[model samples]
Target: MDLWVAGVDGCKAGWIAVFRNLKDPAATRLHVFAEFPDLLKFDPPAQVIAVDMPIGLPERVGAGGRAPEKSVRPLLGQRQSSVFSVPSRAAVYTEDYRDACEISLKTSEPPRKISKQAFYLFPKIREIDAVMHPDMESRVFEVHPELAFWRLNGEAEMSLPKKIKGRANAPGLNQRRDLLVSYGFDQAFLDQKPPRGAGRDDLLDAAANSLIAGRIQFGEAEPFPKSFTRDVRGLRIAIWA
Candidate 1:
């Protein structure tokens, strides 16, 4: 039986995914799903799915935000800001931004406020949080593309931002594309522009994450917090790479 692994990243259109067949390296494929659950519809389901989204959310705000973000930010160094603090469960369930902010302020120990950027991801965050179950822990995991790239770059954070525009060529995007090429992905495929709503960086990120999922399937990946706590929903709160 052929084994498959996948990496997913959120995009303006929805989720962009990269799927790879472990037994047949040439069988890599790219796809777009309108929703998170749609990813599970593959004929030979992905044995491991690593996503670039916050999976486990905190029930109440701690000293910082989610523990995974705190643990991962330090390792990212210059790229630390890429790890957004996940909102608490209460805040995530709140529909209004003002209400969410108020809930976060009232529930958190240190009253950490949700950022506009973080708030923007609330719908996607909630979508994953709602669909994930404890049983899916091993099969589905959380990853950060920046951290994955950092690991691939010999643990050094890339100096250039991954989404710079207006240049003839983006060094950061090229650097990541080069790394993916080294890992056996087709350069032509990786260089192709994404669909309408998805950006080039989103495709690269999904590709990187798919590589991480492959590592995880082969027992080569590691989680951020060696010891992690589950939310009320039993989702493990940690970032894997």
Candidate 2:
């Protein structure tokens, strides 16, 4: 049986997904979706999906971000900053940045404020939140690309970043690409221009995530926090890599 799986990442268009067959690494599809749910409707159906987005949002956050973020940060070392703090559900749902920060301060312990960068992700976060149901947790999972790369690099942090100074760095990207190539992905395919609305790095990120999806399917991938936690909505609040 050829089961399909997807690795998804948020992109300018909405989401960039790399769907691959568990049995055939060469059989893959790269696409940019207009919405998160559209990935759900993918052809041949993705039995497993690992996405680079926050899954569970707590009503009150502690000193670090979610347990998952805190749990995985130590593993990434200098690369840890790639993991952003996910605020409370109330803050995420709030419209204005100022109002959101106000709500977050009240909801979080030690009074954390939302960063503009994290605040900007609210729309995409809400997009996934609105459509996510607890039942889908069986197939859908949360992932972090940098964390995935860390695991790929023998549990060590990547010396190069995918970007530097807001610009794509070839050496950093090729370092990641080399890792995926070692895992059996074709370099040329990964090197191809990403579909409109997504960057090449987005393509590579999605590809890394797809490999994790396969691991999750085979019970090979491990969850951060080493334990599962759920939110008010019953969504699991953990990052898998």
Candidate 3:
């Protein structure tokens, strides 16, 4: 009985889908959240939780300047802050939490009461925080050294265009997102659905990135950041086991 947990981060809320047994497509659960409670109820055994968010920041965020090289801005335009700079493209859609951060600048818009930070990372931070709770902590980090590697080295595999880096993933972009979602399913069940569109597709891509991280941590693949740890914008998964 393998367990796979997948999540998609939308503008205002997120949609989480859980699948068991890669062989059985029908055995899946999808949860939509407007708030944090939606993620609380179930605690499956031996599950891999994948998330989309920046897990680390530039050295400026901390006292010591010990961030990794990969997270550093390119040498050409290095002055920009290394902290997860909000994607300007995502700002156009005011509904997405990522876009909500930039919503305050519109001259015609009236000031909203929500905190911008909360607009982006609220219940998410809470959900992760809850994992630290005594009851849930054991279920999460007991046997996850791979995830520990991610915390120590936080950069997406697709740091730059594949052309520049000369690194590309298999199944290509066409089925990448679906493959990611499918990763959450048990090894027996596999899916190859193509992403429907550009926007939601990004969500799927993020999910896949989480899956990639999980694979590395689980010893299914080689672990990256061989020598040191750096931070990037994404979720953090930690397990002691």
Candidate 4:
């Protein structure tokens, strides 16, 4: 059976979702983003993992003034579609992965630019993702790269506002929190027993949706792309798997 794992990160932090047998449209597992270790339970299954964040940087810049600096961007848009680039920072530093180079030339000036690759841990996920696409059918031992939103509905706008009525204490977003609740109620059927506290329910919702996105991408469920669009409620949307 096809398996899907999805991770979502917003302004503060995020959650993850896992869906099994998308073809059946009923098998799934959802977890908080911090609970990746739990994935060990299922062993190896034909899987696809999607992450919700920028995968690479637009240019290579020195980090910590070290010689081991790397290229930031891992994918580039050609005309209208995005394509993968190099697998390593050093590989792109020498123009070896010219195919993955961004069409626009950019420079990182001092002061405005950061000085450490450690700070770019999140950005490097793109490189990891570049390495994952070839085996979308492969079972991953570690957390892989991919997104849950587009996987479920294909391309659509994601507008997660910064404030919420009952979840003001929860860090990050109002819209996204609402979305989580919606998913929990409509998709996961957890609406009746929502977690207590200010943002607990919201977090649960996010985790559930992220997992659903994973299942959708794993081909366990059919995506209704024909009903979706690029933008919704003024938020820009992006998809990478």
Clashes of each: 0, 0, 21, 14
Ranking of all candidate structures by their lDDT, best first? 2, 1, 3, 4
List TM-score per model, in order. 0.95, 0.97, 0.41, 0.39
Please report the TM-score between candidate 2 and the true structure.
Answer: 0.97
Output the number of the lDDT-best candidate.
2
Task: Give me the overall lDDT of model 3.
Answer: 0.35
The local distance difference test score of each candidate is 0.87, 0.92, 0.35, 0.34
Task: Count backbone clashes in candidate 1.
Answer: 0
Error of 1 at 181 (Å): 1.0
- After aligning candidate 2 to the native by TM-score, how far in Å is the CA of 62 from where it should be? 0.8
lDDT per residue for candidate 3 within 1-241, as digits (tens), equals: 5545443333334533332333343465444445334444555422444444332222222221223223333321322232233222123224656344444333113322334543455444444443444344222321111222233234223222212232333343334433334434432322333233313333343344334434534555332223434323322222121
After TM-score superposition, what is the CA distance of residue 122 in candidate 4 from its true location, in Å?
4.9
Error of 4 at 94 (Å): 20
Q: List the residue pairs that clash in candidate 1.
A: none
**Model 3 stretches astray by more than 4 angstroms:** 7-11, 18-29, 35-37, 43-46, 54-119, 130-199, 206-210, 213-217, 221-241
- Ten consecutive residues with minimal summed lDDT in candidate 4? 68-77
Best by TM-score: 2
> Cα RMSD (Å) per model?
1.9, 0.9, 10.6, 11.9
TM-score of 1: 0.95
Error of 3 at 67 (Å): 3.3
